[model samples]
Target chain A: MKRNVRSSLGLVVVGFALLTSGMAQAAETYKMDTEGSHAFIQFKIQHLGFSWLLGRFNTFDGEFVLDQKNIENSKVKVTIDVASVDSNHGERDKHLRGKDFFEVEKYPEATFVSTRVEKTGEKTAKITGDFTLKGVTKPVTLDAEYIGGGKDPWGGYRQGFEATTQLKLKDFGIDYNLGPASEVVDIYISVEGIRQ
Target chain B: MFINTETQYGVVSIVLHWLSFLLVAALFGVGLYMVDLTYYDPLYHELPQWHKLFGVVLAVLSLARILWRILSRSPTILAAAGWQVAAARSVHWALYLLLLLLPLTGYLISTAEGSDLSAFGWTLLPGLFELSPALADWAGSLHLWTAWGLIGLATVHALAAFKHHFVDRDSTLIRMVYIKGQ
Candidate 1:
């Protein structure tokens, strides 16, 4: 009985060593499949505090590192072209890209860099990141759900995620008062990436 | 009565003239009214389609009218001094210029998104080309100022017609208003 216990304890220590050394699982770096149009950063805000104004940033590229063995080490980085803001209406989109809103001429890009990722559920995580927009940086939390992952038709691996976050217009230095109800913008992100 | 006779406007010219006037006047009134509309108003969605459809109509008719004016002979200026004749001619050309410009600038504004614009449930025209936002703003400004200018010039044209009818007692206004039975 003592010999059996000693052998079992030795096996447990070896398993722990392999896990701590990260030799059993390797982290994968995935590039967003933006060229295939499988990613979207969609947003909606109240219009004049009366109705919804739907829009999206058309051009963006991003990548993420998924450490399955340790999700805390996972990271994400994304950059968006502010000039590609499309709100369906030409005049409104133009106005959004001008000095009144995004000021794309002055600051043409918005970026996000993840600082921490905490697993909240089997298929969900809370990703905390520094989101910079219009030259203002703030810590934002994204409630993310892993959608799916598998081999692609071309013999490549792919993973997908969906996330949601709410941002205040004033937090990004966008002080243009679009009225009381238009102050907060709800963001929904659906991202699909290819293993690279 | 279907063609010009150098003394009176024919039936076609009279019809086209009144139609153009009515369309332009309606567009001016509607466009002015739309500027004050709130987002929730049903007319906010409905009015622009009708407005743009009628704008297309005006654009087509304006081209046809200009072609007709050139192809057909014009009636003589009646009971007018040389300066009055010059003023009338200048006003006519200015009106033509505005008719063409208002539609073109409006087109520029609509097609800036590089997509097709719909009018009254029909695809009117694929954008000829996409315009930059700055250029689109310039187009909008020109559309507004030229619309105001068109309304002003049209008013002057009408006042001159009334002057010939009421003060000068000439056939100038009657010729445009009436088609000879013939």
Candidate 2:
């Protein structure tokens, strides 16, 4: 009985060592095609319980790993500059970046690092990640769909995807009280990556 | 002349008492109204600035008031029961504590996101710490609850004074308000 416990403890130590040293990955890494201006992170929400107001973050970069044989092993990491939030209207954008909304001067960046990726269908997956925004980190899930991958005209191999998610403004520490109707914002993203 | 005697409040004590109470009342009223305003309202931004401005004023005044109370003698309670004396002492201590607590917690919440707290074109407290969301949330909860606690205790304190004047027919309330020596 004691020998059995000894072997179990040995296995636990070995597992911890493997996790710290980074286990071998069987996925291909791809860099986001941000230089070509082919990526988008946009959001929309109800404006004053009457109309929809749309906005997008213009500057961000990310990378993803795709295991073709097993999609569950895929990983994604993205960093977005919160100061780049643009609603097209200059005056409103100024207010959005101020103390009322994002407070970009204080919290300059928002980031997402995937913790789990589960393949739900042949072309769809659920990506759960820890998303940090406005100095608060919360777990968020994105419903992602895989698009086609092909060789571009510039002679580079590329893969494309689209995803959607929703976030509560107050949950991210943005408690500016924009009324009950504007509580949640719908996020839409289209990412195209180049094989590296 | 500014020090309290055996049976009467000093001029300084009376002034501090009225000033702090008036400040607390104004701050609490403005705080309740400001937190509920929508983003579109002009007062949404204006009120918080004033709130923090006055919060700084209260923080300094409350500290000075506590110091003065410690350095001076308090007038003896007249026509009071044993339980009333103890309750009044406890209530006075709690009021002073909460008065200081509101601003301390407000400082933590305001500076949590790495921004210095500024009031009336001057920086009151520097953001010496980094961004701390957990501390910010904790302080925010404390600030909200303590505001109500302070107001509740102040009401009880006032009622106690009224009880002394009306029910007990004593000179307790009059001593604090009415001044002598021209």
Candidate 3:
């Protein structure tokens, strides 16, 4: 029994060491193609005397880190300039940046940092993370699916990922319309990254 | 001396005040509502257009109101309890700024962020500026935050009006209201 235990322990240690060495040696950098990426933040509120109003945040920047061989070793970082909140109107956007809501002067940036990733398939992943906006942070999960990945004719690895997530603007310290603007804000993202 | 205005405001003041109120309220409601509808409904494609149209109307009304306020003399309130008068002024100013800022920022953010210059099918407005991803992002954030600010101001305004109407039994509400009499 002791011999058997020793052999199992030895195998586990060897496996761990091999995995660590592989990760250390195989670090690949991915470059995000901003032109090919889409970032939109959505919001909704009660309409005048009726239903809910809907819209999206029109501008954002996306960041991605990926290794083709080890898909598990991927990371995504997205930064949304809070000052960019647009719902296709000028006056509304200005109000959003002022004191009662985003207070953009104090908190200029809204950011998302991924925590854990669960691969659902060869091309789909469930990423969980914390999204902070207007000084409020909340756990958000995105359904990320790999659209397609391939090597370009120039020999650079290109990967495409699409992710979608939703949250309440109020969660981010943007508790503007308590019951007027529906508390929920849905976000959608589609990205195409290239390995540098 | 904490008395209300002796007479009703002029026709222009009444129109501008009510129009501005309705428009600002609509802007806030519509702006916040649009955030989520685009996600689930494909038919919601027209929403951006509506936002643009209403935004322009609000902007124009707000500009006109500002001009009118500047050009004409508005009825002055009789000396009020210090806190009530200060609160009223602050809320009114905040609402005015929000009315102007929200629409302008939304327009700039929409136009500058991309080439979708014709907010709706309307070509009345200039679709001149091109959108920069960075600038668009910044403008978008600013717009959203400003919206929240508007919401806050609105809440205060509504609450104050309610206080005058129900709690304080004051004429502040009556002055703002367009009914036959208090």
Candidate 4:
């Protein structure tokens, strides 16, 4: 009777260990549902020193991994279709895609990859990343907020995030000059991801 | 010589009249040339600044001229037939209306496009309206049309002045050109 009890206790200990390790390794990978998800990337720049000209990129794709237990281990990656810039004018849009601005034919994509994430609050983080635009890479920090994560009605897990950052167009090699017009551009991004 | 009398206009009216004439003529030339410039043209950005600069100046001067017209007296129309006097009066009124409308429409277009008006590096008016492409296009069309109308009317006005001077042998043009009894 004493030997049997000892053996059962040892098995229970091993089972408990396995269960905890499995839980620790369960870092969820969220794939970007490009069709169902909404990803809006908008920008604003000063026009002729009078007011901000608001514009947006109509097409983009991105995904991010969420490790709730290990928050620092979370990662994000995004790719933007540069030619999709729209400022509500066809002629201006064409000029923007020309050599004076994006030169979209030669360099068609802009991308961002996060290097580190630091949690500043329960739901907010400062994500430092390398942003590549016009073939130039520069370090930028996005102030991000994790909106929420949950099981969707369709039996899929989903996560949402919104972030904002600012960059100088001149830094990205976009040196088009309209005197007194602002070179600093404000960028806003909102993304939704699906658990793959 | 600073005021207008029944027979002649003062020095102020003559100066304002000729100054506005020269400005309007120059603006028409610049306006026509700048519209044809493509995005890649070197003057594409530079030319608009100049246009806006001069446009604002013309608007302010035109407004002042209107105010001066109200505050000051005017020389009587040169002795002529009833229809001739009426035609001259109508043309003069149309010219004044065009002077105000051209700048006003241009301002609306520029501001609607979210662009400020500046003159010689000094900001005159900051754009305050949200950008509406439709409104901008409409205002631009109106500005162009009004400018052309002003050009046509001004030509007719100059011809009328010449007719009064050479054909009618009246002091209609001379009164505006020289002080009283020159």
Native-vs-model 4 lDDT?
0.83
Q: What digit string (tens of lDDT, one per residue) describes model 3 on residues A80-168?
A: 77776766554355556666568877888888888877788878888888888878888899998888878877777777777777777
DockQ in order: 0.17, 0.07, 0.07, 0.03
Span of ten consecutive residues with least summed lDDT in model 2 chain A: A86-95
Query: For candidate 1, lDDT tens digit of each residue in A81-177?
Result: 9888888778677668766689887898999999999999999999999999999999999999999999989998999999999999998988776
Clashing pairs in 2: none
For model 3, the stretches where C-alpha displacement exceeds 4 angstroms are: A1-27, A35-59, A68-70, A153-155, A178-181, B1-182
Worst 10-residue lDDT window, candidate 1 chain A: A18-27
| Shift of residue B92 alpha carbon in model 4, Å | 1.5
Error of 3 at B107 (Å): 11
DockQ, 0 to 1 scale, candidate 1: 0.17
Better structure of 1 and 4 per DockQ: 1
lDDT string, candidate 1, B45-111, tens digits: 7787888899999999999999998999988877558998889988998999999999998888778
If the candidates were sorted by their TM-score against the true structure, best first, what order would they fall in? 1, 2, 4, 3
Ranking by DockQ: 1, 2, 3, 4
Q: CA lDDT of A32 in candidate 2?
A: 92
lDDT leader:
1
User: Per-residue lDDT of B100-133 in model 4, one digit per residue for the tens?
Assistant: 9998888776665465656567788986764444
True-vs-predicted CA distance for residue A195, candidate 3, Å: 0.8
